[model samples]
Target: MSNTPQKPVIGISCGDLNGIGLELIIKTFSDSRLLELCTPVIFASNKVVNFYRKSITEINFNYQSTKEYNRLNNKQVNVFNCWEEEVAVNPGQLEDAAGKYAVLSLQTAVAALKQQQIDGLVTAPIHKKNIQSPDFNFPGHTPYLKSFFEAKDVVMMMCAGSFRVALVTEHVPVKDIAKYITKENIVSKLHIVHKSLQRDFGIDKPRIAVLGLNPHAGDEGLIGNEEETIIKPAIKEAKNSNMLVVGPFSADAFFARKHYDKFDAVLAMYHDQGLIPFKALASGDGVNYTAGLPVVRTSPDHGVAFDIAGKDKADASSFLTAIYECIDIIQQRADYDLNRSNPLKKINPEVFARMEDEDIRE
Candidate 1:
C-alpha cells in the first residue's frame, strides 16, 4: 500500500433532479473522511445542486466549487456543470429537463473518465425509460456504459458492505432469463467476478458460488437441465484453471448464514435471483458496481426514489459506501498494477501453493 502510487479521484454522475440523488450526493460529500480518500467532483448542474441543498438542508451549501483538489478545495464540493439548460428544476417534479440533465451529467463524467481526469466513477440512479430520447434509449446504467465503452468484460456486481453478487443477465424479463442463459454468458460473468474479487477486494484466492436457475438445483435435472448442461461445464473448466469455483447452489438456501459465509461472491443466474436478497438486506444501503471496466465504477444500489424526493428522508449510507468503495478499488488496482510490473519479486509459488492447499483442507 505504501509502495502503491496515487490517490483516487471520484467522478459522480448526477441522476434525476426530481429524485433523491442530489440530496444523497449533498449529504454524503459533507463528510470530511471522503475528502481525505479522494477528490470528489459532481457532473451536474449548479442549479439542481443548489435547489436540492436549500430544499433539504434549508441552507446554502457549506462548500463551493473548485477546479482542482487542494487544501482549500478539500472542504468545498466541486461541480462540473455539463448541461447549460434552464428550467424550474424543482424537487419531486418529473420534467424532461430533469431527464436531460441526467444524460448530460453522465456524458461529461464519461468524457472525463476517458480523458484520465478521474480515477473512478460513482453514478447516481437514473430513471431508465424516463431518460428515453432518440439518443439515450438504453435500459440502465450498466448496459448503457457497456455499449458506449464497447466493453466485452463489463458485468454488474451489487454490493452492500461485505456481501457482493454479480449478475449473469440483468434488466431482462423473467421469461427471457431462460433464453439468455448460455454457456458463454455464464463463463464470461464467472471470469469477471473472479477477477473483480482479486483486483477490487484484494482476495488472493476467491471462492465463487454459482447460483442455480431453478429450485433445488433443478431437482437433479428433472425440472431444468441448465445445471447439468450450461453451469457444470463452466465450473469444471474454472476448477481446472486452479480457480476456487463451486456450485449451482439453490439461491434460496445459499443466502442462509451458514451457506453465504463460504464464498467471496455469488453469481446469480438472473436479476431477481441476486437482487431479491440484496434489496431485502441492504435495501437503501446497497451499492451497484460495474466490474471489469478499465476504471472503477459504483453507484447507490436503489433507484431514484421519486416518491420520497424533497421529503428530506432519503438515506445517504449507500452513496457514502459507493464513494468509499471507489477509493478502495483504486488503491487495490494501483497495487495490482505495481505488483505486475515487478512480477519477479512476487510471493513465492511454493508459499502460495501451500496456502491454497491449506484453504482447501479447511
Candidate 2:
C-alpha cells in the first residue's frame, strides 16, 4: 500500500440552483491551491455547472462527470450529476424546480457520505421556503442532517478564528425558546458540545462557557428563573461529572468583554443569543458546523442570496472557510479516534496501578 495519506473527498451539495450556491463553489474551487488539500465533488448536474460557469466568472477548472464516486478524478473537480432532466436556471429566481433540484443534490450527497465514499460534506446555502417536501420537512439543514444521520443530538456550532459558539435552541421561534430551555435539553446540548470540542476540535480538556437564557442571567431570578432552575443545575451536573464546564454568564458582557477568548467554546441559550454575537465577531468568514454527527458536515454561516445570485457579488470567503473547517475537523477526528483506541500507556507501573485502583474504587 502507498504510504501517502489519502486526501479526503469533500462532497459539495449544490444549494438552490437559482441562488449563489454554484457561484460560491465555482469561485472557491478556482484557486488551484485548494485542490492540493482535498478532492471536491459537486453534487450537481453537469448542465447546471456549465450554466453557472457560463453565467459567472471565467474559471479555468474542468469537471469530470461520474456516476459513481469511485471514479472521482483527483486532478479535476468531479461533478456527480444527480439527475439528467433539463431544468431552468434563472439566477435570483425562487421557484419549486430550484428547490426540488437542491434537495435532490443534498440527498445524493448525504447517501454518498453514509457509504463513506465521501469523507466530509460542505453544503451550499438552500432556500428554506421552497425546499420543503415530504422528505425534507424540517426547517433547515441542521435538523435535516440531524435526522439523516440519526444522531442522538447535534449542535449547530459556528466558528470563525478564535471564536466558537454552539446553540441550545436553533431555528425555533423567539416566543417558544423559553419552552425549550428546560434542564434536560440544556444538559444534553452541553454534553454534545463538550464531546464535540474534545473529539472533533482536538481539545483534550475542553473548557465550555454556558450563557444564560435571560438577560443578566435573569438578574439572579428577577428577570427569569431559568438560570436558577434549569441552567445552573445543568452546569452543576456537568462539572460534577468531571466536565470542565462553567458559567450561566450574562450574554451581553460575555462577548462585550471578550470573555469568549477565555474558553474553548461557548454554549448560548438560543439562536440569536449565539449567532448574533458569532456573526458580528466572525464578520463574513464564519462556518456553521454540525457537531455530534457520525459524518462531518459544515456550511457557510450564510443564506442563499437570491438577489445577488448571478451578479457575482456573493462573497466566497465563508464557503472557503467552511471547506477548510471540514478538512481540519476530519483530520482532528481521526487523530482523536486513534488516540482513544491506542492511548499513550507509558505511565509508570506504580502510577498506572494507583490510577486503576482509584477508578475501581470510584
Backbone clashes for every candidate come to 0, 0
Model 1 agreement with the true structure over 110-185: per-residue lDDT tens digits: 8788777777889998887678899988888887888778889678998876778899999998878998888888
On residues 267-300, what C-alpha lDDT tens digit does candidate 2 reach at each position? 9989999999899999899999999898899999
Candidate 1 wrong stretches, greater than 4 Å: 1-5, 58-60, 66-75, 344-362
- Tell me, by lDDT, which candidate is best: 2
Looking at candidate 1, the ten consecutive residues that score lowest on lDDT are: 66-75
Instruction: Look at candidate 1 and tell me the lDDT of residue 269.
Output: 92
How many angstroms is residue 229 displaced in model 1 relative to the true structure, after the best TM-score fit? 1.2
lDDT of each: 0.81, 0.89
TM-score per prediction, in order, is 0.89, 0.93
